[model samples]
Target chain A: MASAPAQADLRTRLQNFIPKLVLAPSVAVIFLFVYGFIIFTLYLSFTDSRILPSYNLVGFENYSKLFRLSHWTTSITNLAIFASLYIGISTLIGLALATFLDQKIRGEGLLRPIYLYPMALSFIVTGTAWKWLLDPGIGLEHTMHLWGWESFQFGWIKNSDYAIYTVVLAAVWQSSGFVMAMFLAGLRGIDNEILKAAQMDGASNFQMYRRIILPQLRPAFLSAFVILSHLAVKSYDLVIALTGGGPGRATELPATFMYSYTFTRNQMGIGASSAVIMLMTIAAIMVPYLYAELREKK
Target chain B: MTLIKQLKLSAAVLALTATTAAAADVEVLHWWTSGGEAAALNVLKGDLESQNIGWMDMPVAGGGGEAAMTVLRARVTSGNAPTAVQMLGFDIQDWAKEGALANLNDVASEGGWDAVVPAALQRFSKYEDQWVAAPVNVHSVNWVWANKKLFDDNNISVPTTWEEFEAAMQTLQDAGVTPIAQGGQPWQEATLFDSVVMATGGPEFYQKALIDLDPEALGSDTMKQAFDRLGVIRENVDDNFSGRDWNLATAMVINGEAGMQIMGDWAKGEFVAAGQVPDEDFLCFRFPGTQDQVMFNADQFAMFDQGGTVSEEQAALASAIMSPSFQAAFNVVKGSVPARTDVPDTDFDACGKKGMADLAQAAEADMLFGSLAQGHGAPASIKNAYYDVVTAFFNGSFDSETATEELVTAIEIAQ
Candidate 1:
């Protein structure tokens, strides 16, 4: 009687808790492996360590060392220049492509994949292909010579002062298509009546785009900017594959410097300290922009 | 009756399994991806197989060995170190100090390594006088590789001195061909700078500046002359030389687009890969002025201590690495001289013979410099300081005077 009812209640509670029990292992795994390691890296930057991890407390020596090295300063400076140029150019180019595609043009569906194909390939493969294409004696220069233009030179990739720009160009080629897709989605989501009214008012093409469309695409720009900035801050594989931080360290970036310090030089403490500085620098740049975006959304 | 029969059968199976255990499986990680390097590795694979050892081959293809190092570090940190890793120079010491290496003194003693291997190589292969790694091959870094046909066509003989070499480069430049085929990466640049230092300053100055971290030597007039020569090299290179791979630079020489390349003996492997015979298609010479000085490093294997079931197997693998037969076979295919001095030179090619002869002479004269490649010969801070000054000079950011001042500053900071 009363015991039967209590037993039924116990069964209901067990049934209700099964989903949580099933999800516990995965949740705990993600937390421990992903988040735990990040915290550990953060903790290591505060200590002075060398070839192996050390627990000895030596506050800010590694950070000061990071500031002292010319390579570190150059790396941070180059990262900023690369990020700004890459993101700004990519967003503009992506917007233009999205707008052109929205005109009900021929081959729109077929051409979408053509532009996006570069994003599918790994950075290493991208770098190899671009290196050949940009090489002086091999690709473009050879092609020009064949066409009887013997004096033509497209050797920016070989110039120390201009090598980093080539990396930026390769990055833009790979990422602009991704930005275009996002912009295209936003363009498609716009209300049809607003555009119709704008046209009805006999508004000029440029004016209509500037006043109505660009303002509405603020969220898309923010999304693309954040993604590009994140990619730029962590840039390593492409630089390594393409230039290898040379023409005499002309194209060296923070990520590559950190890698060389940690593994190649066996200065784990200095490497971690550089990584911490990079994180702080990124935070300083992104936090205000992120906060404004969140507030605007609210 | 059935239960008794089953129990007897199980006992018999257990007894049979206990009599024989499976052969130990060893996984080796390396960065030898070129055709010639691949051929060289196969020789080692065959030798390992003959010893009843199973090899797990993990090859990462990049000449600079960057990608391979990254993957290795990740595996090691995660407690999954390979049985052996093909390492160069200072990297062995760096890894050993982290308590990851298996001490190989017993194996070294059994193989009589002390009698055959050079004392300079021992600095890198040993930590605290205990053999923590096995040296397989020695690679000399200051070799000048040239296209014999191109030189002959241009009516040029092999230059015997630095001044003559400069004149030859000028002649090649006048003929509208690139005089030097330089890959514009950092390590390649470093290689060129080191060769220049050897050519201009001789072995003693090189030892003082690179190995001893002597600030006074770095700021000397001899170092300034080296920088001036590098400036000449920079002017001679084709406009599109930046970011090129060393092998690709070798390809240019093979195709007759360039006349010469200053690189390590490993360039011989590249030449061989392209189906070019040593004395027929190309010639290997010591960079003219540095003919008496040999700057060398050894490729060695450091075994990591993997606990549990693989412990005994790891020790056996380490022992097998130091065996005389393995060393001879591995080095011959690698296009490098064996670490042991007593190995027969019968299997070596013309270039290998020349290398052996030069190595012998340099050793006898006490003109051999250990390395800046493997961190054992010089401290990392000092090496990087040199790299900074040398790289800046190569890029034309600093002139000879500025470079000399910077070199002094670099050494001061390093000390």
Candidate 2:
């Protein structure tokens, strides 16, 4: 009996060790490659590095310069606007799509791929395609003219003031479907009995969605929000492909600014400092929510 | 005893194999990804190959050379650098200061580079009196490329002054055509601004404002006049011009939607790609004002240091790049004048010949100035400030007076 119990304990220990062994390499790779390079970049930011990396420390000179640049300021401002609009609009539209699709709409199977396919393509290609489609003279306006609306003007992408919104629209188009999928999955997993009980109490359709369904979908909302926020904060390929931060830097974003400084201008120290500031800004926005989630999980 | 003999024999065989495989593969990085640019690069590649050298091309496609620089910087920082990189203006100096470039003094002297290349080019290509980069071709940024048929149909001749150009544009606009094909991108805006500045303010004021970063010059009445001229250009462009690509703008002129474009000689490549011949389908002229001056920026290949084990093949490749045959062959396809003044003009087009003649004249008169596009004239900060003010004026953000004021402010800040 003692030998049998000892053998069972050994077997349990071996099973537990197998999963850790399987996961260890990937976890180590993430730490060494992703986290390690981030720390290295952070260290470079504090130094007066230029064309090549140097260890001559300059404290916060680079950061002060970054703050002084109008491009940097404009980029950060654009980033804030982009993140809010993209997140708010995408979430609402995604929720609506998911909810509507949950009503057992005809052709739901075909429509799901239609919504999700934009996410399947890279943002660069999407931005290029959208840029052409939204171009005033060549695309929508031209199509409108072909239909005899000669005075049509759909040139938002060309307008300096409205260009960033066009970027937001394209981004939303690409990512809303992803959020829709998450919401759909969450909607499908909800208990039918709860909804039946709500209906039994004579709840209105809108009230049921507002009071019961939305509250229950909080986890999915949080998940979608975090994903969209990450995309917004680090958005570079879209801007590069669409506008190239043009019309006199009106549509410039933090990532493009960092890129221009680091590469074109060869101001690595300033570039690294900007990167650090971006990282800190992202963390500041996300840390509290992450902490709350982790605490709740515990 | 038998095992030891076998090991010795294998070691001898390995050494022989290594010696046979010692050809140095020279990796060259460039930003020429367009069809014409790719064709131009093939000439250089062929020249290098003929020298018994292996050429590894790393081409990144972007109009401004920004993307390629990003990749090059990463490679250099990671202790892995290409043997040569296509660089412009202060980029050479910036890299040279980091001790990232190899000293090409011997190569320059052997090629007789000093006599053939201009002194201004030497200023950018050398670091502390040591040759760091080899000049390939000179691109003039102030040429007015126009559709000859449009000009003929409108009964308009090439403009000789800023006022004449504006009137010509208005004439074209009235005839139901887009007058100026302007790319709304900042660099394109800056290019147009530079052309106007040279045309309106002349070389002296341009040098003071752009190269010297003189606040007074930036705020001068003449500079204001330049901005006003740019304002005219802005108004002449079509409403849907914003965010338009340079090639598309060229296409506008190609398809006869626009009458003219103020761009660098590289615009000729687009014309050539569209099957347009110089002086026949389209014509190239220096922007109005015979004394206006030509702003020149060269594309140079700066050799990076590869330590003591620098391969013989890379040395051969570098030598081949500076050869007269390569200069003539590459520049012919590149739609720019050869950097070497001694190269024969037979292979050049009519406009290219004119460019070469003007270059010689400018060289003699000392009218050639550094261009902002290539970053030769000023520090990056000051250049960007100039760009900011120019772009602001171009985008109708400010009037000419306000632009001049902003220009002075920007210059002062940059200093």
Candidate 3:
């Protein structure tokens, strides 16, 4: 240690400084754009900003007004329905497909990509394609009628009562394949010896899988739930492209509400309040999951 | 002249040409990307090109400039405002209030725009006694485009009152035809509401209920009747109308699948594009009781205040927009009447001629009013508030009385 002089110590310090120098710009950008804008939006929520951002504070007025709107209540109710269905359906389908693939089925590689194809597409494309397919006049219903099935009726997209489910259907179609890949990876990581041991103990396929295999996929389920909940809370483009928050604001989500009020409706204060609420929603879902993840690693 | 003097003159002329070529071109942000609309904009672009002014086009398309407005907000907030922007009524006023719009009084006076433009359009063009925007075209929302064959087959003359219109629709429905080709969008629903309010309550009551958002007017029996009329129209629309685009609804009328569409004059371009002649293949009439009244929405271009003053290019662009010749040429292709009331109608079609005449008469009689559905009668916040109530009423979420009550409450909250 004494042989190491000031020159060596200085060189070591310079080497350590290089990594921070490289990372500083990105860190600064994220802080300014992500956290700084979040703080700014939070600040604007308390102000009476309209059409453009103003700084005149009118604390909690926007929030109180937001809660009073039936439109906001409708959006929150829709979020509850969409998130539950999207997560539930996607997880079930993913697990089933992953289990099927784990059976060492034929053409696994070909079938895997085919199953995952929809995930590769952007949500906008999915929304648009689903919109056409679900339209009664010129899409599936039209084709069915042309096929001489005159009694065929599938107009869920047009029905305000079932429109949110259509959003869920498209979302599930796009994401279930990704979830399958997650489960497939998790299933493959399970030790082959454990399965063989269960079989030797005379455990049937259903019992072994139900008691052992399903319980082992906890992390996958947790991750999927966390990911889907946030995605549901922030869903904007799919609804806009598919339903445009209509046939009478039936499919309006919080993100669409925020964008509409801020830009189209010229109610920036209400928009900002809605946005802050959405961010807090995401944080509520993500923070506990992240904290558990880090604590587990420790 | 000596050789040296001739060379000096030639060099000076070359320098002048270079500077003119290097002059900043006007960058215009607009949402006019449809086929006919783009062609109409080409007329103005060519006009500017003729005067040695270059045009830098910035086109964004979606939701009738809603997406474009979002992009404009981002640009202006970032201090990269376009030289000019295509704006609607209160949007120009909103931007003017923000002090982001240029004062075009210099160009306004030079072109003598005050006398030619109608007062209703001028209401949007000028803010605080200063010209902030140039009126481009006027679109009236009270027109019904009906297939002539269907009307003739149904033995219905052009209905001139509410009872007659309802009777005709009932006849069409009995014949197993969809009576009204309506798109189930909030804005389209509100457009129908505009004509209905004007028809059911007359122009004066419409001014009070929609324009002024008076509590008494909004909650009156007249408002309830408007909702009931909207309910009648709703029953005539097909089940497949939900999430359908406006053009597709127009196509339904053109293809004989539906009887009529109550829409703005923009739908005329669709008929024209389909090679359907007016008063022949299709007939355009003012909604039954709205014959004497016009519900109008005008497109305008507001110049942004770059460097705290209007650039020469911006002034030239604004001047060209209001010129009688350009207005005529543009509106003729654009399926709208000229914003300037003095423009000649020789180039207009049969329907266009009717629109022009109706607009002039309505203006002269003080019966012309802005369309609330199209963001001219009120600001966006209030207009959107009306949209929620109107759509809910049309979709059976609210009865007429509840709709009237909701309308009052919604407007008050928005205010």
Specify the highest-lDDT model's number.
Answer: 3
Ranking by TM-score: 3, 2, 1
For each candidate in turn, the TM-score is 0.87, 0.89, 0.93
Clashing pairs in 3: none
| Residue A79 CA displacement from its true place in model 2, Å | 1.6
Judged by DockQ, which candidate is best?
A: 3
What C-alpha lDDT, on a 0 to 100 scale, does residue B55 get in candidate 2? 71
lDDT of 1 by residue, A51-161 (tens): 567888778877776776666766887787788888989898889899999998999999888887889988888878888888777889889999999999887777777
- lDDT score, candidate 3: 0.90
Native A-B contact fraction in model 2: 0.44
Indicate the worst ten consecutive residues by lDDT in candidate 1 chain B: B16-25
Question: Residue-wise lDDT of candidate 2 within B279-361, one digit each (tens)?
Answer: 89998998888444769889988888878433566556667777888888888887888888898999889998999998988
Residue B101, model 3, lDDT: 94
Candidate 3 C-alpha lDDT tens digits along A1-298: 6767887988999999999999999999999999999999999999999989999999999998898777788798899899889989999999999999989989999999999999889889999999999888788999999999999999888877888999999999999998999999989988889999999999999998898888888788777787777778888889987888877988889889898998878999999999999988888878988888758766
DockQ of each model vs. true complex: 0.47, 0.42, 0.59
Q: How many residue pairs clash in each candidate?
A: 3, 0, 0
Candidate 3 residue B203 Cα shift, in angstroms, is: 2.2
Candidate 3 chain B, run of 10 with poorest lDDT:
B18-27
Best by TM-score: 3
Task: Tell me the whole-model lDDT of each prediction, alpha carbons only.
Answer: 0.80, 0.83, 0.90
